[model samples]
Structures are given as C-alpha cells and as structure tokens.
Target: MIRMFIRDEAGFVVSAELVLIATILILGLIVGLSSIQHAIVSELNDIGVATGNSNQSYWYTGFSSEKDFANGGFSAYTRGSAGNDTQDDCDNDQCDISCDVPVNEGPKSL
Candidate 1:
C-alpha cells in the first residue's frame, strides 16, 4: 500500500519597507531638483535687473540731450524717460532719478 502526501505552496511576498525607501529617495530627488530650479530662476532675475539698469544708464548718458529728451530719446530711450507716453514702443517703462513707473500707468517722476 502507498500513502499520498500533500504540499503547501508559498506565495510571493511584498516588502513595505523597500517601497517606503524608494518613495523617500524619489521625494528627495524631486526636492533637490526643485531647489536647483529655484536658485537658477533667482539668479536669472538678478541678472535681468542688472542688465536692465545698465541699459537704462546707457540711455540716460547717450540720449540725455535736450532734443532727445524732448522727443523722448529720439526713439532710443523713449520708454526709459520720466514721462508716461505709451507711443515710445519700448519695453521698460519711463524711469527717472527718483522712482520707477507704477504698473497701473501712474507717474512718479523725480
């Protein structure tokens, strides 16, 4: 006579610890990249400000004559003057020795 034996099969196991570790690593990488992007943007903003001042200074020095001032830099520093004329076709609004132009089209010439 022969006896039959039954065997139990083992199922696959999923480790929660490994999943948590992977998630933390991904979050850290995302945070690091975000910080890097923020720093780059900040530096670019600073650069833009510096270059803007330099351009404005050039306009002031080169086009500060009475005639150019009357015609608003003769189309050179047209938008970099102390007035509020929107026909100058310039990017930077009118600026003077005291304050900058308001975003809402107000004048504060110094």
Candidate 2:
C-alpha cells in the first residue's frame, strides 16, 4: 500500500497568502503616501515661484498696488524716522527735522 501526503494542509499556505496580501497593501499605502508628499512639495514649489515672480515684477517695474505702495511708503518713512528722532532728541532738546529726504534715497536707484 502507498500513502499520499497533503501539501500545506495545516493552514500554513493560507497564512502565507494572507501575509503576502498584507505586504502588498502596506507597499501600496507607502507608495500612495509618497505620491501625496510629492504633490504637496510640487504645489509649494509652485506657490513659491509665483510669489517670487510677483515680488520680482513689483521691484522690476517700480509698480506697486495701492496697498503695497502705502505700506512701502509707511515703512520707508518709519525707517527713516526711527534712529533720526532719537539721535536728534539726544543731541538737542527738540526734534528738528526736514522732509527733503527723497524716497528710495540709497546708492542704487530702485
């Protein structure tokens, strides 16, 4: 008489199949997450480029929107007045000043 043996009849094959499916699922999840990360990075890079272009255009053309022009003027005046008033007050008793300072009064024209 001859005896026949059953292959993976103890649920081992089923468990191996489950493990393989789980591994594939995990790998898919990893790839999905990486794609999402890449998309976010790409979007951020695009936004950065757009903002840089806007700033460059503003500076290059010496053209600013109303809000930007107002803010720039305020900042320029504030910066010009910042140390001068304090120095003048310390040097003398009164805050004597002049408005002859031109906007963008630097070595290079902007």
Candidate 3:
C-alpha cells in the first residue's frame, strides 16, 4: 500500500497548481506593498519639501516698520531773549567798581 501511494502520480497536477497559485499571490502582494510604500514615502517627501520651501520663502525684514519722527523745522521752537543788560548793580555798589577785588589767601606754596 505504501509503495502504491509513493508511486502514484494522481495529485501531481494539483500540487503544481497550488504552487503556481501561491507564487502568483506572493508576487502580487510584494508588488502591491512596495507600491504603497513608495507612494507613502513620496507623499512624506513632498510634505518635507513643502515645509522647506515655505521656510525658505519666508521673509521678515524687521520686527517693526521704519518710521521717521523728525521735526522738519516746524517743531515747537521759541526764540531766545534779546541780549544782556549792561546796567546792573554788582554787590552793594556798581558792577565795575570793586568787581576785580581779590579774596584773602593763605601763604603761597613754592
């Protein structure tokens, strides 16, 4: 019986068909999974590229705008007085009387 079973070629075609079907399924699965992975990687790369582009294109000259608050000759300016008065009393007498008097000093140093 064992020898007859070993020598039988009845299920040879069925085994070949099963192997062919499994190989085709495995190849299809590998191709489909690789395509999905490629697509995901491409999308992530695009997102990264977009981020980099936006960052690079961003321009900020300064935090605030340049404003000139200069007063172009129209500011609140007032003219000074005329001059000086040459007729003033100095101490208890006239300004030119004892104006050149020197103070009392100690001994002079060598």
TM-scores for all candidates? 0.39, 0.38, 0.38
Clashing pairs in 2: none
Worst 10 residues of 3 by lDDT: 55-64
Model 1, 1-110: lDDT tens per residue? 13332343366556898889989999999999999999997797667555554432222323323446555544333334342223333233333335666778678899
Give the candidates in order of lDDT, highest first.
3, 1, 2
Model 1 residue runs over 4 Å out of place are 1-14, 56-110
The alpha-carbon deviation from the true structure for residue 92 of candidate 3, after best TM-score superposition, in angstroms, is 90
Which one is best on TM-score?
1
How many angstroms is residue 43 displaced in model 3 relative to the true structure, after the best TM-score fit? 0.3
Order of models, best TM-score first: 1, 2, 3
Clashes of each: 0, 0, 0
lDDT, each prediction: 0.58, 0.54, 0.60
Question: For candidate 3, lDDT tens digit of each residue in 1-110?
Answer: 99998899876465788999999999999999999999997796667555544422232232333344563343344444344323223322322323566889999999
